[model samples]
Target chain A: MAATIEDLAQAVFDGDSRKAKKLSQKLLDAGEAPLDIINQGLMGGMSEVGVQFKAGTMFVPDVMAAAEAMSAGVELVKPLIAHEDIQSLGTVYMCTVKADLHDIGKNLVIMMLEGAGFNVINGGVDVAPEKIVEDVKELHPDIIGMSALLTTTMLHMKDTIELLKEEGLRDQVKVIIGGAPVSQDFADEIAADGYSPDAVSAADLAKSLVGAA
Target chain B: MYRTRSLYTTAGFQVQQHLFWQMLTDDQCEAIVSTAEELLERTGVEVLSEAAVKVFEEAGCLVDGSRVRIPSTKIQWALRNAPSRVTLCDRKGNRAMMLENNEAHWGAGYTPTEYYDQEKEEKRPFTLADVEEFGKLAQMLPNIDFATQGGFPTDVDEAMAEVYAFKTLVKTTTKPIVQHVRGLAQAQPIYDMAVAVKGCAKELAFDPFVALHVSIEEPLQLSADALEVITFAAEKRLPVIVSNELVSGFTAPAESAGVMIVALANSFAALVLSQLVSEGTPFITGGFFTNNDTVNELHPVGSPEVSLLGGGFANILRYLRIPSYGFGGATDSKISDAQLGLESALSTLCAGVAGTNVIAGAGVFESGLASNPNLLVLVDEMACETERIMRGVEMDEDRLARGVIEYVQPAGNYLATKHTRYYFRSEQFWPTLMNRKRIDDWAAEGSLTLGQRTMNKTKSLLVAYSPKALKDDVVAELDKIAG
Candidate 1:
């Protein structure tokens, strides 16, 4: 018997990445539409994970694992779906700011944004402002998120925003900053568009920023 | 519209067994008792009051001027005369506390000179208003068994502070109080106020609402003022708490055994005095122990030595079958920070484990110089934690969870089961000021620290509080006496 789309969704919900990939392959082999598989199967499971995570029934690692399964399943169907039909809430270019090697907080935000149906370009750790600017210009992402953990490294958030202003790309995207030391006051002082104290709130800030934009 | 009421009441945690932290052996305790008896016969105790000396003289002890040498037989006779268990009843004649066995009750300490203002984050001299507020706050806290005279208020007349503090406390709180007075003169008015609230002196005597605290001056001296209070309290049949503060290496011997001997001996002297004043009087006595800092010479309230000595003395008191009071939940930290938390929690847990009845100094900080209302809430939570720790482990049929275990075998979760729902809340020690929330949720709640949360909780509780009103006649009489 052929595995159904619901089975793929259940695999994603259970955070079974290998099973999700196998099920996604099975669904694609059965001649199902890749967009329908993503929207109805992968996103279907991920939306529930989002709800559970917000309700505190599902913790951070659980959501991260589920998002991993979703990403793996999405990867399997990416070639099958047309570029224009890849449905996401928005595109977000995210990174840990320059001079800071911290990636855990930034990675959490990426996972949370991906779980919320956003296409997150994870410009990984030790991300320079020039590289972010180049990627943002190329990707035309709707939102940009930055993270820094140390009080000394947090000033790089201001430097990154200043570089964005210098590149005349500050107004194009909604900028957000986060980390332990980054407060809402610091965000305003640095002239970033928004601030979030934690990963979940970072994703929510992205969604609302894109919505308002 | 129909009103709906919930059928089941919430089941809160109740600590079962008393935690016994006995550091001294039976032989060691007996040795201390005999040594104390020898000291009573050899060095003797200085009876500052002539009446107290006469009472000792009549008891057939050697009375040489103010020094009355008591025989071991008299000490034994006094110990036998005092009741082993004393109940400090509330104003309504309710058994608020049973000071017996390893049962522990906690309350605020006596007579700190300063009060910690939470909003200002500064220490200030206490006023009469602070006493009233402390009484109300203590009454609100479930862990605080009795309200205490928090500190001597600088705003009131120095001579009348005790009376004013007592008057304010009795009117504001219905819980039993542990009061410390200036002299014997203040004891009667405080008793009169309790009697007025309690309806009569006899009922108050039957179940005394107040426990008079008298401390023996250090380095082997019993003052006349202390004897006056003890005699008055004994005659009124009120419970007297004879707690002696002896700092090791300064007022007492640096070694634990010697300190223990001196402290126990001091307590024995008071016990003898009370029994002599009135036979079979309910009395609580213990050695309140602390250590002196070698470099600074400052007496540190939360030393490990204090706990060991306190525990050893408590064991001796239990051996003698008398209720004991000792210091717990006090700190040497000037602020209610990590040091205060760590010190207060450890000391209080030690005291509770030692089974100190009516453990004092719950809210005191900076080595008993200041009292913090916020720390009071924190210490109360610590007491709740101590109770949970001392509750130890239960091994009954239901607690064994055999049925739940069989139903949910390996790889099966007990969550969402009826058994889990029934027992989960009752089994855990839930804290109010302590945060168990996630980092995100904590940040969303304004990122308040533990101390801040306690302050907010305390402020809200105090603001929303209206103590049970005293009778009009009682109020008039109290005011008259206060004036």
Candidate 2:
């Protein structure tokens, strides 16, 4: 046999992203369908990772590595996928809001979302609401995730939502808010669709919002 | 029949009282001060406040915009004028603490935002109640000599939190407080409160109850607020602790010596400011120093480098004959774990040996951002260990006990002897909360962890705590001043 899908799955499961990319290219050269390599080989390994993570046999970093490997394999097949199917689950626009330069939590959510095979556009730290609204209009993401470490900057998240509503883009995507100072009540009062305490749960919330979970 | 004697009774063993261990050589200490002096002359300091710049200018120092270049003689004059020994009194005007020699005083760190509740195993913004409880705990704890405004209370007005915390501390404990204030504006109310407690401003000035701490901006700078407080402290005749923050490879040079020079220079600048304000203001000099984790790029507060730098700084300050303020009994670990134990022990040991005066950073965790009462209880145990280590071996004929050794030489032990009883209580260090149970006994009693045992001990301490009440008249005066 020239190569098997099992080899690709093994590379991804081992979190060997470089090897994953190489093996994925080999499978494609062997005339394997790109979708077959993704769903069966990459996602298959990731599914196992999710199971192991829930079972407590695998940790967050391990899952992250597996997700990274899956992402590497998926990058090889990305050009071949149909435009509508580019983001397998959904796309998210993430940013730590203006006047809050803190990014530890925001970056965590971005990593978690990307690991779950979502296209994450990390709108960088100290991001203004206008810039986010402009990006939201251009990207038309499936979910908008806002984070702020400071209580003052958290208000800007509400302002961003208001701008989204004014621009008539509120109905198109779900709004998810989180951070150290952010509470569920704050989210509810601001008309956010969902809220999560931490990154992993935020990824799950993003999945559920897009009807993928 | 011979009676069985256990060295460790209910809790654990203790180290006998000893002298603080020294880590650096005399030549090394002299080099550090020289380096600090050179840096001060070459780099100068950015004094942000116009008033402070004016003061520096009037003191015959060269002022270029905000930067003030003070010659070595100016610093020497300030050092000579500044009181080397500061006596901090309790509210009753009793001289409770003398900050001199190589004596180390373990106290709490100031303004931690989060308080870790052991019962719930959760961290939340500390309320005024937590501040009050911390005061009570500090008052009751044997190892903690003084208290700080432990945390910012969420319930109180954000601007007034420091004064409120001070009010709570003054009421809850009679221990001398190292008050953390915002600016000269806030210092007035705190000064008034101290004056009320000590019967008058003149009496408060003569026997200072609260010592103010002001931090300088890193890389040779002082904020307007800091200068204001320094001036007020100088005028009020209260002791002031000038601290600086220097993270290796970030705010300061990656070299350990460079970081020390930066910190000490900042303290020297503050000393100059204080002397110009008033020639004989009592001052302590030291600051925060920790190496940046080269790989993670994070400031690990409990790094071994922190211990080395802290210990080195203490030695240098001792050589300078100024009271030293440095970190001790704190950890970078977020939770109670082996890492916490190791880091806290190492830092406390280094601080104890190095002779850091007014050693703070006890109970602080998560790299100085959070604090817990239980963690404080554990850190107290570590302080006791440091105290014992610092005490070292008390070498004398009585300690040797040649006659007693001969008497118990062959078969009999020293149990039930008058010499043993007389020396047993003083010779051995007894831990109040440390677990020393047999394996079976420990497992049988539910296999509690050190954290659990500490929580239990902390709870009892809080329950058993009875505040040494401030008189109603004093309370009324305090409330009026705070308002």
Candidate 3:
């Protein structure tokens, strides 16, 4: 019997973590591969939710519930997926800059990044520039994401990027910045790789930059 | 009843009078009035509502599509009907007349910008409990005269959330509330809640005792949702505090004068629309103007020019015979540190002296990203002092020389005089935290920064405070909705 995508998609859409795990497991047992389940089930369901979210047809809670469901499905199939397949996508390191402890934007990026199947290292908030550079050096992350909600702290993003350039590591990794005060022009002026207004778009930019999409 | 006192020091009064003198000469003021007339005649503000446009057209305004050219006569007519003094209502059926003509009133405000948390991957829906708690905190604090049900409660259903929050706030505190509603569906509910709290019926609620916070993105292009809210609130005869935020480069020309003109045009447009909706709805016209720094392209409120613009706008609002709203305690700095304090104090003092009716932006941080309850406690102290400064000292001939010299000659010290005993408390604001202990006592307690002290104060308030319990029936209804 051909397993319809709707059953697997419904499990993710319903935010039923238990059913999502079971459905993905059943799909794999029925001979569908793990990558197929991720591409057609988890990613597909999340994409639909993102559209609804942007259109205001659904709100933040709806998106959160849907993300939870997709995360559940991803958890079930993660062990079955090969390391080589997972490693195909590049890594992204994200953090809110120092002296700014707020983290709603950073968390949204993490959710979107994980849903998009990228390896994400969350450095959390008020992250010092030295720590970010150290993480960059050790992790050799392909992309570094920085966020600053305050206009005063946003200057720290510029300082971190300057430090990276001085260390001869600017060319090694792509840097993307976003927050309330950050704009596309500001990102361009700061000479960063990109800027996204919101989290889902940030995921799209991250994937495109790394040639994962 | 508390008697209002002048809150001005000589230094503060001189500083504002000088700025006002520099910004507007008689000729310059006349020029601005002429420019406003030109704008009305030539460009005319767009009236999105068909009925509002027709009202203007019938009053001899030129209509080109949605834009209605408000002739000088129409502007004069609208201003003539606008009340110079309005009684804003409190929760307990008491009222305060915010004199709108020449005199300014001072009141403390709470900033409402922190509800969006893009970083935490979580948006907390601020509940009715949060609103009630905030109101209780405001009530206990000596700083605030008015309370805005704490900014953006996350738990609220956005469609009609503010109505519930305002209802909760009115029940919890006696302070006059700054009622704000954002969407169309919320208008009727907010009106109903206000009437119920004010103990009035749908027919007689036109008491001009309740204050409604009305905002517009542009003068002519009001938010469709906000307009509905204003209309519903105005029908109850509430005084509309029509305010606008003019981003120098983006919203208006980069020139300060241009920005002021545009803000004035926008404010007047709102005033006209409000009047058209309900003829005698009292109005407060004002704008929040801060230039975008060309170097940073970020709007910082601390610059001297920004202060000048705010002062000028306050003067303009007074000239138009309406009360005004001013930004108080706002700073570009992210952290709740020295930068926040200096910027907040300077900007707030400028607006307070310029005779603003309601001053906001207190206790906010991260350029309005975060609202720390501790910062609020500190800012309230500043507001208390600022209000003392706004009430200018009486200097009439009899009070100035007679008792002062006679008492001083006899006693050699005014300490024993009745005037000193009567006016000491009125002369200065007693701070809650600033002078808590002597130097040696403070040293024994370990020198704590204001931030630390504020944190302690916030925690104490949060722990000790109990909000007024919602009605059992309303609580059950809300619980069912929450589920």
- Candidate DockQ values, in order, are 0.03, 0.00, 0.00
| Top candidate, metric DockQ | 1
The regions of model 2 sitting more than 4 angstroms off are A1-213, B1-18, B410-412
Candidate 1: which stretches are off by over 4 Å? A1-213, B1-16
Q: If ranked by lDDT, best first, what sequence of candidates would result?
A: 1, 2, 3
Residue A186 lDDT (model 1):
88
TM-score of B-chain for each predicted structure, in order = 0.95, 0.93, 0.82
RMSD of 1: 10.9
Clashes of 3: 24
Per-model TM-score on C-alpha atoms:
0.69, 0.66, 0.60
Tell me the tens digit of each residue's lDDT in model 1 across B1-483.
Answer: 011223244355455555578788899899998998899899988888899889889889898899888889988998899999999888677999999998888888777889988678788887888888889888899998998877778898887778889898888888889998757878888888888877788889887888988787576678888889888999999898887888888889889888878887777878888898889999898857878898876888877887788878888999999998888888889876898888889988988998988788888878888888777778889999999988888745566676777776876655434466456666889878889875656998999988889889998889888877888998998888777
Q: What residue pairs are clashing in model 1?
A: none
- Against the reference, the lDDT scores of all candidates come to 0.83, 0.81, 0.69
How do the residues B76-122 of candidate 3 rate in per-residue lDDT, one tens digit apiece? 77788877666665555566445554343433333353532323333
Instruction: State the lDDT at B194 in candidate 2.
Output: 86
Q: Distance from true position, residue A161, model 1, in Å?
A: 29
After TM-score superposition, the amount by which residue B462's alpha carbon in candidate 3 deviates from its true location, in angstroms, is 4.9
For model 1, how does the per-residue alpha-carbon lDDT over A111-187 read when each residue is reduced to its tens digit? 77876778889888788888888998899998889889889888888887888899999999889999888888889
Q: Please state how well chain A of candidate 2 matches the true chain A, as a TM-score.
A: 0.77
TM-score of the first chain in candidate 1 relative to the native first chain: 0.85
